[model samples]
Target: MSVLELVEADFRAPTLIASVENTKPPATVVDSAEQLVDQVIKAVGKNIVLGAPLAIGKPISFVNAMYQRAKADPTINLRIETGITLEKPVGKSKIERNFLEPFVAREFDGVPDIDYILDLRAGKVPSNITISEFFFKAGSFMNSPQQQNYTSTNYTHAVRDLLDKGVNVIAQLVAKRTVNDVTTYSLCSNSDLALDLIPEMDKLKAQGMPLAVVGEVNTNMPFMRNHAEVANTEFDFILDGNSKPDHKDYSLFAAPHGSISAEDHLIGLYACSLLKDGGTLQVGIGSLSSALTYSTLVRHQNNRMYNSMLSDLNIYNKFPVCKSVGDSGKFDEGLYGCSELMVDGFMHLYKAGILKREVFEDLTIQTLINKKAISTDVSLATIRALLEHGAINETLTTDDVTYLKRFGIFKPYIKLVDGNIIAQQETASANLSATDTLEWLEKHALGEKLIGGVVIHGAFFIGPKDFYDDLNNLTDDDHRKFCMTSVNYVNDLYDHMLGNQQIKQAQRKHARFVNSGMMVTLDGSVISDALENGQVVSGVGGQYNFVAQSHQMRDSRSIIKIRATTFRNGKLKSNILFNYGHNTIPRQLRDIVITEYGIADLRGKPDHVVYTELIKIADSRFQQQLLADAKAAGKVAKDYQIPKEYANNTPEAIQQFYKKYTDQGLFGPFPFGCSFTDQELKLGKALKTLKAKTATTSGKIKAIANALQGPKLDHNTEILLKRIGLNKPASFEEKITQKLLIAELTK
Candidate 1:
């Protein structure tokens, strides 16, 4: 059958299919295993696709299954795909963690499933997983087939490419969905915008055709505010299956203590700088993203430090970003969110007193829009208002506006003016209530009109009860925001939102970045992929979108940060490796690459100059080697200078800094928020002490002494430690410290 027909069948299926239930493993395995196998599928070939619901460590079992299957059936091909990847926690037990078990197991298990597993850490490759691939999950590997690094940043180019490719079937995992008048699903790219596209199956469908859904199954799906859903029938086929397997208790990693990587921090700082005081910001979770947001928060909270930093950078002349969103971005007016990964970052923004809501109206309701309140079936006026306010400054021209008004925003009635509608009689029925109000606002209130309900429909799985509760109890206004149907329709709406002018601008920027990718170099020689040794650690996520969008935004810029070298197996190497077989962000599109050493100003610069700047940011340990390599390759001139000032910011310094704070007991693992019991905290501290003792060069005794005498270590604790390790005679002070430690552990 054709892809279109298959999609139709899936969307239109009348009966619910049998739901897959997880089988319990042997009791012995269950008791010993912190990580359990959710589903076991048999794949005969090396090339096998293990499909299941969203869960942690699905990758591990999938990999194992593929390897075993491939081993038994040697002729079968092997491939791996997962909805998400997890980070391994430090000093965590296998039984207590999910990622570490998979990782360490994978290492010991070896590459039995050859070919490739789509390394997310490094970005795009065939096989051979690298150590760098464990950073964090970005996007889904299931849709990697549809991911194309397009040259044009324009949404249309993306649309045109997909359309030309004749792709139609768009699969998404959503808690709930709706069928809009349009033929596509309205998937929220962020709070302010959505994408309507079909990537997998699109063939022989007449233009302006009414889309049909197939089979759909509904369960206890979490309903989230600030996001919307789609109808089950919106899909050509919906699988009416019960809930999939559960993968709860997924352990998360603790942030590394003491040594903060400067390169990551620099990138975050630069990105934060790009966000106008009130401009909407979309940041995922990671050291880099966290660093940027934290830096911004710290700057706003600490005026002295903020002033000093700005003065040192001589940015006093630049537009000072109002650390306050209301004062700066006018977020109180409303801000949009566009991101693939919806980390708690948005929550952070909301907690920080940003995240505003705004309502839109049609020209018919233009006057109401002026009043900052519009009750309409359409939202063009609101979008236009946002554009005027510089919230949507993506360069959509008049012609683009015309196109959107005609077909993009999808309003059935263009004749009805918003003002003429009687207060009691409205086109869209709003099932609003005080409960919904309280849930959405959650103490966050804006104007009478809560206009900031965001719609996001993608592969979703609600982990806990409380999380689900928060998502379900949204107001009527919040419900209208969701239009989950097909990925194609969602992407289409996104393009329409972009309109023509933005599309044109995106195209120009796209060509530039793509061409630059082609011209990317190794030793300064052009190479297609910049990834070292052609290894793909991670796939290209929405990097193209953000980069292209930044280029299209006249007032914004894209910044990429990579540490000069990563510490692995105890040694650090140049992050800007001499040659990479794989590349995520190429030099041509390399806008601002920041490292702890310094920033590499690559944009609009020649190869020679760019090479020198990049080398300057190379860590001191590897600067000489990198420059020598570049010079040998004739990428840099013989007299090319590597700034000396950039050197010597060693891990040792970071260690000292952390040690100073930790000795004082100020370098806490939970600096922001933590819910660990006091006993747990004491246990953790005791463990740290034990680890510190073992890590010291003089062995356990010396390390114990150093730790006990550290600034934060109690005065009594020093005597106790001396007694415990037999370094000094036991005394009253020692007795008191011992009692304290014991009490902490018991309590």
Candidate 2:
């Protein structure tokens, strides 16, 4: 069956088909990790081609077992392909090592051994073993030689590339459940890559090639009831045992709360305001997402406060686009979220009632829905549009009735009888007067059918423990609202299949993809995944796809959020560089860029306009240098001057302005929610300050001097030190380090 057919089929009733050979090989049920290893060893030749899903979808027991087997047997050559390997970094320097080793040990105690990552970092990776991932978590492998040599690929093409490179063994974590005396395994978190892989693997197997598709069932894995959930028959091996320990819960990577600056909130306020009601939204995972979510909540729940915040920021006067695109009130129609990672922030939005809009499959119905001409209640105009678009015939047939009911055009009870529409006690002829037909449709609760449209569509999800809990706790109906589909569909605007292209694009309207960039050039070139020096920070995942798609759609926009400046070693540096060595999204694809300073609309703008607009949103301290560089390069007029209002875009100015509102309980760091304790939060901030201080020579000297002075500690300081396990130092070196930490904290 085709992929489209597979998608349309219900998960509860999977169609079993005979193979090309008229017989199918049954999946083996392994009782333990040892048995799984033995099977892998027996199935493998000299070389092992392994593929797994990113992050949480990874089969921990199986992979660790494979790693151990590979280690003991030198003849077993292993090639692993995956993405976003979640491993804690081994600190490179003394200070970094001192802080991170203890911190991680304390923070992630009892976490399962991610042996692969550990081996890779320790240079213990067998000479024959190769690890390749298309996208790495940002800054995870900054100094690793092996990772440095690994070339990056886009998210959409990762599976194809892996397969081409001879990935024959695929293993992923699955959720096992027993129903009707049958045990089934659900892909759970990541069916994004698996959906494409399974079909290809089946084709290859039919051609008589050797392939091992393994599903390691973990009882702890939440059985996500969406496109991701699948039957056990899909795999070649189902590894499960009641006696086996439950899969160790890998705590979801929690983004530090309130990491968002006041400036971030300013940018978020502008971006959130631009989002139209009933439009599609795509957001990434980070502090900026939290900021945007918080701002969106404020806009919907407290319009007066939202407006006041915008007014204080002078958003209307600064960006003319804000006056036109910004919505001042709550979302009656709500928004449809389409994102790569269904981060915890979406849960907050869903709970706030902001992520409530639902879009249908047909273009005609979608158009009417977008224009507010049609909803659950069938209107005369809706009927006319449906007829004009050939969605429904003048004389409603049984086929037409089924189609209408399917797309939410007709109420569930509204049936066609003798060429007439009947809803409970009301009946109207198909050829009746428009007014009478409208009255009949409106009298019944026909709109209820479309009320619970998909709130969010994600490819895969990985967030805080609370995020998983939220998903698990949702009612079946609410859970169904969070659809997990393939990255191919989520990342791209059009599908390769001709039939689904138009349908996919129409579903995603008013597309606002909010992504973050480390640095953006004056001419609108975005550098996100890597630095100018060719050091990889994060791999370019789906930013390019979203940006390109934004330009393709008429009303769509890709808003790139960036901080105006970053503090490095206690010195402020501009993120708006004149030029960068690498570009993820080129100047041609640039749509909208936002910084804490302001918003810059660069879409369809000329070189000079782009340069000026970008500079307008840059830190005031760096604007002159950028302007000078642009002028020297003949990109900007020599007479161009920095605007008077934008001159106040200094860090000090932003901090002061942000403090006023923050004091008033707005624009907080952890505005949505934070996982950290109050004490941990305070200590984290202090430790971060100390780390930054240690990076500079003068700061180090100051720290040493403070250590020599040995300042007396108060009750709060002593308690804080004990909380971080530094109150009573065991060694002289530790005692000195403790004194330095105390000095830094007190300072």
Pick the lDDT winner: 2
Off by over 4 Å in 1: 1-221, 225-228, 235-267, 299-305, 310-335, 357-534, 631-648, 651-747
Error of 1 at 194 (Å): 13
What lDDT is obtained when candidate 2 is compared to the true structure? 0.76
TM-score of each: 0.52, 0.88
User: Alpha-carbon error at 658 in model 2, in Å?
Assistant: 1.5
lDDT of 1 by residue, 1-747 (tens): 111222333122111111011121111112111121111222011233322212221323324433444445545543332223443332333212322343334332321222233333235443321111211233222233323321222222333443343322222223333233212122222111112333122223335433221212223343332223332223343332233355232121222212224445444444444444424444534565556555556445553554454444433232222231112122333333333444343444544554333222122223333344443333434444444554333444433323233322322122223322112233321111234422322222112232223322222221223323333564554444422222222222243421334332322211111111222233333222223443323444345555555555554445555555554433345566666565555455555555544445565678777777666656667678877888898988898666545555465644554455346443234333443444334455664444443453455455445435544445554443443342242776544444434333332
lDDT of 2 at 208: 83
What is candidate 2's lDDT per residue for 1-747, written digit by digit as tens? 212223342211122221221245557898777788788667655588899898788887789988888888888898888888887545564545644566567555655757888887778888777888777787787867856546578888877887898888999988776555554556667867887788788899888878889988766666765466555567888777755576444443433344776777777887887888777889987778878988999999988988888888888888888766556778887889989878888889899899988755456776677776677555556667788778777777777766665545666566778988888887887653466666766666244455324677788877766677787787877865777767887888765421156766777877788899988999899999987777788888888888887878887889999988887657779999999788888988887899988899999899999999999989888889999999999999999998898888887878887888888888777765665677766777877877777777887888789667867787888887876567888888778777877876676
Indicate the worst ten consecutive residues by lDDT in candidate 1: 13-22
What Cα-based lDDT does every candidate model obtain? 0.36, 0.76
Quick one: how many clashes does candidate 1 have?
A: 90
Clashing pairs in 2: 258-669, 258-670, 376-447
